[model samples]
Target: MAPIVQGTGEVIVIMGVSGAGKTTIGNLLAEAAKCTFLDADDFHPDSNKEKMREGIPLSEEDRMPWLQGLCDALKERIIAGKITVLACSALRKRYREILRLSDPDHLPGRHNCSVKFVLLNVPVEVLSDRVNNRLANGEHFMPPSLLQSQLELLEIDVSEGILQVDATQNPSVIVKTIGDSLIQTKASESY
Candidate 1:
């Protein structure tokens, strides 16, 4: 089956705490949707990566530029007419707002671009196990010790236009659920 095509100017953010399979699921979602996949990690500065490696949670000041960079990249893709999927640990509502808003200096009329967030909800035990395994395998820079800090900062509000899914499910199944929901959402919005 063809992947569900997102509406024009829409950017999808696969968001959750660490070990919620953001990268894995985001890549699959982008591939299925025939869009570009962007990992928020790639946009992080060396200092941010080092802090995370040392098990330090970043302060909002440390994250501001990183969020702005992601925002710029999303804006570029949107202006170029490409659907982009980003995997990010947008753990707080304020952080998500930063992503959704365009830098007024750069794009004056594009405040709060169309963004859909997919929050991957997983049990704490499962999330811990995943983090431990990922660290053991040296798959990512985020240390397992920082997972608690991330969860503590996570804000899951329904008003944020989030589609919550069980992260423990098969990746394909999860992707299908997101795709189906997007389709229905778009269909309703058209009416």
Candidate 2:
């Protein structure tokens, strides 16, 4: 991991399982902070998407390259002095570490940023229902079958600048709760 020149902005990771509302919360956080919003899914290669499309769950090996992509994107934006809020499925501690360290492509301006991870958690039933509804839309490549693997891989590192929120809660409530936490953490100092 390459340390950034100087830390100028915060990197908030909205993380959780597929239906945990990471996208919504991350987008809201980005809007409130007036920073760039990045969807981690966009970094996935067609092959990975194809795997998911075929209902084959992605292993950690499958995710490392994608995680590296995230690191690169975050590293680039951090170097350019642009704050970014990312929605990712950083399930394990290793995954989190890789991102925080900007592994693989540890650029010059990668590690010089404050990082906060927010986990959106909900009951499995709630998540299952959400995934079902999402699938009903017939657009996402993520299969409901992959949800179990994500749940199993998830390791809640609550002390690593991680905050936990109930995903099944209303969107406004979730956003407000997270916004308040961001303020309390001084992550929104520029806001």
- Range of the 10 consecutive residues with the lowest summed lDDT in candidate 2: 103-112
Q: List the candidates' TM-scores in order.
A: 0.92, 0.85
lDDT of model number 1: 0.85
Report the lDDT of model 2 for residue 114: 60
Scored by TM-score, the top model is 1
lDDT of 1 by residue, 81-172 (tens): 67888999999888888777742233323333467789999999999999999999999888989999998999987766689999899999
Candidate 1: give the clashing pairs: none
Q: How many pairs of residues collide in each model?
A: 0, 1
Full-model lDDT for every candidate: 0.85, 0.78
Candidate 2 residue-wise lDDT, 1-191, digit = tens: 11222346557899999999988888877777677899999999999999998989887788989998888788777666666789998999878887786423343333333666889989999888888888899857788899898898899754465789988888878877887776765634545
